[model samples]
Target chain A: MSAPLRVAVDRDACCGSGNCVRTAPEVFDQDDADGLVVLRQAEPPESEYDAVREAAYNCPAAAIEVTEP
Target chain B: MSDTLATNVPTYPFGNAGLEPLLPDLGADGVGRVQLPTGQQAWLFTRHEHLRELLRSADFSSDFTRPGFPLIRPIPEDMPRRPDGSLIRMDPPEHTKFRRMLTPEFMIKHIRTLEPLIRQTVVVALESMRAGGQPADLVEHFALPVPSMVICHLLGVPYADHDYFQERSRILLAWSSPPEQVRDAIEEMRDYLTRLIAARRDEPGEDLISRLAAERVATGEMTEEELVGLSVLLLIAGHETTSNMIGLSTLVLLKHPEQLRQLRERPELIDDTVEELLRYLTIVRTGLTRVAVTDTEVGGHRIAAGEGVIALLSAANRDADVFPDGEEFDLHRGSHQHMAFGFGIHQCIGQPLARAELRIALSEMITRLPGLALAVAPDDVRYRDAVVFGVQRLPVTW
Candidate 1:
């Protein structure tokens, strides 16, 4: 089986557009206080892989990072 | 690849006659030099990949005062240019400071909290239009008022004064408005916002302007002048862009009855429908303008430090490689990657709010007004000659 996906977010670089949260709510969320990305799951399940990738791809600020095994 | 020579460059802010503006041939690389109405020559990138690179690059500056900034219209010579806290026209770390201050206010979660307010506003607009009977101007009755009232409520601006601000905003946005008129409009908007800011400072309320006045301005985190500029930007941008999108999206949907039927059948598709409509109608027809602060190579073209570049978002949204059969409107086409709200740091900050408004407004329109149809012939419809693409009036009946 493939290794679990790795995800990271840079709050400083996050313009807080929240595309990540919308695209992959299971893996990501917006901080209620600041609206920056809050990494809910650093290693999400296989089912969330596609959505996680799309989130990284579509993020306007390029603040989301994903690593696949 | 052919290079568009300076002598033969096409004029931009292309005409709005067709569903999509006819873009001039920009050679194999999808990059060309075009002539602005100001008589300035700027590099135009039409391809999706090229726009992503150009917009995301930190070497480009959004400051209009910069030498070689691609100005779509000529500014009056005597008008003093001070774009203080106009976040769209600013570059980091200044842009960051202002954007961060307001990010929490517009995040999806915060916008979700405003859904009740948006729905109420939408319902009120629909009912009001219905009260006027059939064959009403949908634009004047529904499209303009919903966003105007919502934004005014959020900013503590009086909706009764919408005619005044809306008229000035029209002049500010119209390409045909003379440079002097544009200058006067800006002054008038600034003067009005200045008074509003002063009022908020003295008597704080539960609104954005009051909050900013009490917190940021009072704490010296931002200045009153900066607040005035920011308020002016939000006030104008809040209503105009979304208003145009609502009007145009309705027209597009009414024309595509099949898709409209699908949306009505599956209300769950409202989210995807909103995305597709935004992608298809990339309303900022003039495109986002920026000037290079450092030499950069984009799409194999060497752009010098002082050169201006225009990211044609409309062209990029319809790039064939990204969206197969991009020309056709498909409600099922997952279009999250489209640059309708633009890209990178300067991406539309009000997008989440815009999305909520569009989803509620369009869904309500289709559901409530079952027999909605254009009262005038399709050919008789008039388009606005403005920075934003929209119908001058949408005469409709249910």
Candidate 2:
């Protein structure tokens, strides 16, 4: 099986458009106070791989980063 | 490149002859130079990839005062400088500072909390429309007031003053409004917000204005003038765009009964329906404007420093590459990548709230008013000739 996916987010670059949270709620979230990306799971399961990829792709601020190990 | 006059440019906003908003023919590359009404020439990027590249690039500046910044309408010579906290017209790091302060208030989690309020607003508006008798203009009865009341409640502004503020917002947005009138509207709006901010300062409430006033302004993180500018931006933007969307979305649904029937049958498709509507009716027809801060290449086209560019969002949304048969609306197509709320740091902060409002409003309207139908012929429905494309009045009967 392929290595599990890893995800990261840069709060500084996040404009809080919430596209990431909406796209991959299992892997990403928005901080309640500041509204920046709050990565919930750095290593998401195979089921969430597509959503994580989409979140990174559509992030307006280019804040979400994903790595396949 | 030769100095092409861009002589074939259509009017500021290309027409909406039918379902499709007309676009200037930007040949195969989907990029062309166009002349603005201000007699200035700017590059217009119509392709989705080009727009994504242009909007997300750091080389572009959103500041209107920058030389070569594309201005669709003339600004009065004595008009006040760009407002201190008008986020759309600002470039980072100034834009970043203000956006960060406001982001939390509009985040998806936060906006979700406002859904109950939005639903109630939608329900009351629908009932009020029915009570007003059939053939009521939905724009005035349901579309305009729902967003207006919600925004007013959030901002600590009185909904009773909507007529006062809404009229000024209309003049401010109208492309045909005289420069003097636009200037007057700006000054009047600022004056109104100034007083409201002062009141919020004195008696803090559970509202956004109160929190910002007590926290940011009082703490010196932001100025009172900045707060006024910010409030003005939210007050106008918070209502106008969504109101227009609600009005136009209804008309589009009425036009497409098959899709409407599908939505009615499966309310779970509300999210998809809203996204499709936003993409198909990319209403900010004037397009997002920016100036190149430095030399850059977008989609292989060289853009020199100080050159202006207009990202034709409506055209980009319909680009066939990103969206297959994009001209046709298909509700099931997941359209999250659509730039309806724009892209990059300057992407709309209130989009989550807008989406919530749209989802709740459309679903409730469809469910509550099953008989909703346009009262007039499709051609007779008047469209707004403003920066935001929408119907001026949608007379509907249920």
Candidate 1 residue lDDT tens string, B1-398: 12234587788767677567669987767888888888788899999998988888898999999988889899999998887979999999999999989999999998999999999999999998999898999999999999999899889998999999999999999988999999999999999999988988888888999999998998999999899999999999999999999999999998899999999999999999999999999998889999999988898899988888999999999999998898889999999899999999888889999999999999999989999999998878889989889999999999
TM-score of chain B of each: 0.98, 0.97
Query: In model 1, where do residues sit more than 4 Å from their true spots?
Result: B1-5
In angstroms, the error of model 2 at B239 is 0.3
Give Cα-based local distance difference scores for all models: 0.90, 0.88
Docking class for candidate 2 = high
Per model, kept true contacts as a fraction are 0.60, 0.92
Top DockQ prediction, candidate number: 2
lDDT of 2 by residue, B154-245 (tens): 89999999999999999999877999999999999999999989888888889999999999999999998898899999999999999999
What is the model-wide C-alpha lDDT for candidate 2? 0.88
Q: What is model 1's native contact fraction?
A: 0.60
